[model samples]
Target: MVYALTTRITLSTYESFFRIVRQILPLNYNQLTIITDYERGLMNAVRIVFPQTKLQGCWFHFCQSVIRYCKRSMNSLFQLFQTSVEAATVLRMVLALPHLPAESQINCNFTMLDGFQIIVDYVNQQPVIRERLQAFLFGYIQDFWFRQITAENISVFGLEFLKNDINRLLLYKL
Candidate 1:
């Protein structure tokens, strides 16, 4: 656990803070997994300071961001998510992507790709909606979730223990 009161939030400030953390903690960078929000500066700082450490984004934050985006930019989709059970289910499934198995299991080889494929398959079922809302939502998912934040950073995949702990923390906070 670490805490610092900072007046400025920037890449250099985060780098300095992380450097201090590195100096104080006897961290095994390879084994360390830091869960954070999708703050670009902080994430970049961590990468620069501890290149080998695994950086995971908070799942709650990811969900919150998606919902917020829908509310602000895609109000029609947001309304559908609230009123339509099928749309709600789809939204839930998208949010649950991070909770799905990151790697191949012994009995079932269900991976993130499989989860995404399921969504794509479902979306493709409706040709009319697929052209408009599906395109927008999938594009947002692909660009922001996949290309920008990345599946590796947002998904719980290989960090079950961390996921459980994070859930507990989230529950406690809520």
Candidate 2:
């Protein structure tokens, strides 16, 4: 629940947000939840401070990252899914899987599901991309949307979706 001071949103400005959140909410709070726009600086700072927090960037922000890293055609398909309930439903199911072969992970920009082996393979295969994706998933994916309602119309991504998204991107099947 933070915004930039000016028009341009930089990491420094974003980091200030955690300070603001801390000032308002006590550090003794163990069950803290953070929702942010996935600005790298803010994300990094949050990690340093709240290592175990349930951090979730909005679905919009998650989609942006997917579009940024995925291929043009894959992005287009995702866009279509975004607009259609049926597609998104199929996508939601397909994206909920948490395991894939090593080669498939690379084609989809190094995203993978949550498992010690899957994460390790992904990281070993592509260190830089794996780091970014892992940061995004952290606590965010681990406890995703236990209370989610279909009317909410936003997908809470976790390692499960990461695995599924990669498969779809690689096969162009879903």
Candidate 3:
């Protein structure tokens, strides 16, 4: 069985958690996995103590970097990317693209279903912003691609951007 948890805290908090877990749980080599937010110091500690555990930076946090680089005004394009590839067919399309041009790569990576959730979750808490965002995403998709169900499109916001070219929005039916 696989288990995952996202905890926000200082390095010391994670250090303490590991220390306590080590003492209480009879942990074995390569039995634990740590998906962290890439705090180098904390990762160092984990490495020193649990050498066999696999540690990876959280994908959710990595997406934030993409969002930061992406244009704020082009958010609607991001939504189309998300809705288009949230499922099996679209996901396969996303997985297949590795060497696409830079602009299209951004669209391909940023529009991932998994990514949209994290971005929109943060956006949704603001006053009236969620509705406005919903409107924008819907309008963008309808105007370009065929109309799609909102729920299905939004579910895969956790997948990483394999391709980054978003400018390709001009070339296809989407």
| Colliding pairs, model 1 | none
Question: What shift in Å separates residue 49 of candidate 1 from its native position after superposition?
Answer: 0.5
Best-fitting candidate, scored by lDDT: 1
Off by over 4 Å in 1: 102-108, 127-129, 162-174
Residue 7 shift from truth in candidate 1, angstroms: 3.1
Measured on C-alpha atoms, candidate 1 has an lDDT of 0.76
lDDT of 2 at 76: 52
Instruction: Output candidate 3 Cα RMSD.
Output: 15.0
Q: Write the per-residue lDDT of candidate 3 for residues 1-174, one digit (tens) a residue.
A: 223253755566666666766787776748666554445566666777677886544333333422332225455534544564332232233322222221224445543343434444555565434554564434543232112322222222334441232323223232
Q: What TM-score would candidate 1 get against the native? A: 0.81
Reference-based TM-score, model 2: 0.38
Taking all chains together, each candidate's TM-score versus the true structure is 0.81, 0.38, 0.34
Residues forming the 10-long window of minimal summed lDDT in candidate 1: 165-174
Worst 10 residues of 2 by lDDT: 145-154
Segments of candidate 2 deviating more than 4 angstroms? 1-5, 67-174
Clashes (backbone N, CA, C under 3 Å), per candidate, total: 0, 0, 18
**If ranked by lDDT, best first, what sequence of candidates would result?**
1, 2, 3
